[model samples]
Target: MPRTVAPARRHSARSRRLRLTAAFAVLVAVAGYLTVQYVTGGTSSDQCTVESADGSAGDGRTYRMSSEQAANAATISAVGTTRGMPERAVTIALATALQESGLRNIEHGDRDSLGLFQQRPSQGWGTEKQILDPVYSAGQFYEHLAEVPGYSRLPLTVAAQRVQRSGFPQAYAKHEPDAALLAAALTGRTPASLNCEPPRSTAGTGGMTKVRAALVRSFGKDVLPATDGAGAETPAAGAAAGALSVPVDTPLRSGKGGTAQRGWELAHWAVAQSEALGIDEVAYAGKTWESGSGWRTERKESGTTSIRIQLAR
Candidate 1:
């Protein structure tokens, strides 16, 4: 003989099983989401990675950062290079920032220290507002750095410490390899080495005018000369309403690198600024990076001479 359960009791048992299954499904879903966030390092954008072409940055030969870090680094490099500071000088600046503030434009630090280099307003770095501006802070760093005699040839820590005068002077040395890798990519010495994922949402609607203004601010007015060869304002290269193109046939600032390097430099700059400027796509040197698609080679080649930026509408 077999014992038979009551109908109500069977129903209750089935309900318990159903509830457990649903709870397990919810747990799995949460675990999957967390794994994704851990892998991407953010909910909105992917991590930025710079690879060393020459096997630098230790055995890893790669450094990964959030897009925010990459943007600050790009600005630092731009400010340095536009001042005719060599790649070595950029490396030193980057190492100092890495040690001081992890290349982030943080507002608070020890006492009055602030900004990317942890500059202290009380120590005459700048007003509190100016020190918080990435471009201004970077410019101030380079200006002080250039005054250091033979800074380019000095040891990275020595040069950086002379400018920063940090409590942890030797700290800059450990960051040198990563800083060198970033400098090579950001300075356009290593083409296509720096790549960042676009943000999930457009940051603003400032469009082409805003983008051009940012370029002039970081790379100087020559980055988009007021006049083209025919003495007219250089027009957007595309017929689309939000398209802007930067001509890189020559170095925007007189410097050692050639036009190809200049092209990649502008292309990488646009990508670094994409989130801040609401850029949808950046195309240059036959490669295109889209908001969701990172960088990919175009089936049809885009010319290498001009960097094209498509603004997010």
Candidate 2:
């Protein structure tokens, strides 16, 4: 056979082998990229980072999230806390959503499932539009989760599976560590733990009106007082135009943390919404987060009880 092989045949076979090898390499590269994206949440410009609850960043215990994922997670935490659900409940809900939708409010899933939690309207989760709304869907999830007997005491997977009834019940367990980190930051138990990068564009539709509306939508009307013009509590005196101050002194009925905790909660929420809300800076508890700079210590100690949200003009 070696003696019978022609030069042209040999070249053709070699070319075919080369093409096949190159194609395989490309396939592997694409697969690797997708797997990384799925695991890291995103590698795009609009990304977010959440450090550990203790505020240690050098330990390699951070969780990276896409801007979309951060925003959805913030909504989930807000919905739960405003409903008086504890941090554990928030952790369970977040883990469930991560497994079901990777924290994305998707429009498609297995057999008519939809939205972040992949609730199926056919199963009476909600109408398509309702299921698609993050706030509503999260609320529905919490409502279901609250009904589970001793959900707080159960294992995270057990609590989540009781609500989701997923074919893969154990899937939620793997996400617990990451979910706990997110819940800690978003729930305000971990101060300055969450930070997001500046958006690519600030020219989108934005204003304090939109910001106030988003806050009320996620944390409920109580998130902002009925006064201060847009349901935001009284603005601080001498504040600049487009600056909105959210007072955190008002105690939450069953919410976790004290005033400082609430302040950080609002601060982190603003950072998570920065890209979409056109926020330029967020200051709370003597720490400040600028659009491009992330978080910096304004002082070691201060009496700041309200979160100041500065919007880009």
Candidate 3:
């Protein structure tokens, strides 16, 4: 039988309305302002500030990264996961972002190309429709790339070349370090604390998971194969009892920490969305992301460490 929408939906709708109000208010202030570069394929002058997931560090100061860059990075990360690719895939993607687009995701670019990856329809990248879609372009890049045997073992450039076949092949190299930093953040190897200000109020909010599901539905699952290492975290997702295993009393951090249930909820969520969210791991409070695909404690950090959801797997 089809399950009915939970009564919680009504309450959730109300909470979402409130949160949207709050999120939009912040968006207006930060929208036109110069936001920091969260991470990207080009050199960045922005300095990073670390904050807990709830948004804070030692001081009361909030953390920051390029809201513009973060969206591009987040998009790539999500697309790669939707295709079931691994961090290496994100790394390669970063290289592509470096060469094609500076990860800014522009509407207009060299010639008729658009978006961060500068895909050109004149060059046979699907129609403007396909090229403009970051997820579609990324998936297309991966599809061609995976066909090149030993790509994972190839030098990043050689591997990238097999796919991009660009005129300026060497240009892709300069973006490596920048791409790596972004790969860490986008792939969840860094920290969620390294987040950007809210996006334009016009860009609706469903959070990462909701966005991910929509992307999967849009792109066929075959874009990423099961054998892809991207499936690494599936085990961890199952470790938790509920689909949304986050316990009822999960802790909420205000630069402090949440209860174990909250931490568990976060950990479970991290693993559950590892592939789709393009996150390799998540670290909150004392827990570390390490369940092959989920977080495993390597060494626990003690003290008033805020509950930071770092992407550094």
Candidate 3: C-alpha lDDT: 0.51
Question: Model 3, 40: alpha-carbon shift in Å?
Answer: 11
**Which is superior by TM-score, 2 or 3?**
2
Please report how far candidate 2 places residue 166 from its true position, in Å.
0.8
Give the alpha carbon lDDT tens digit for every residue of 183-217 in model 3.
55544444433422232332222343453354344
lDDT tens digits, residues 158-276, model 2? 99989988766887899999999999999888888898886657623468889988988987766665576554445452167888877787645365477777787788889999887
Query: Where does candidate 1 stray beyond 4 Å?
Result: 1-46, 54-60, 203-206, 227-239
- TM-score for each candidate, following the candidate numbering: 0.79, 0.82, 0.49
Q: What is the lDDT of residue 89 in candidate 2?
A: 94
Per-candidate Cα lDDT values, in order, are 0.79, 0.82, 0.51
Q: Give model 3's TM-score versus the native structure.
A: 0.49
Q: Is candidate 1 or candidate 2 better by lDDT?
A: 2
Q: Report backbone clashes per prediction.
A: 0, 0, 27
The CA lDDT at 282 in model 2 is 87
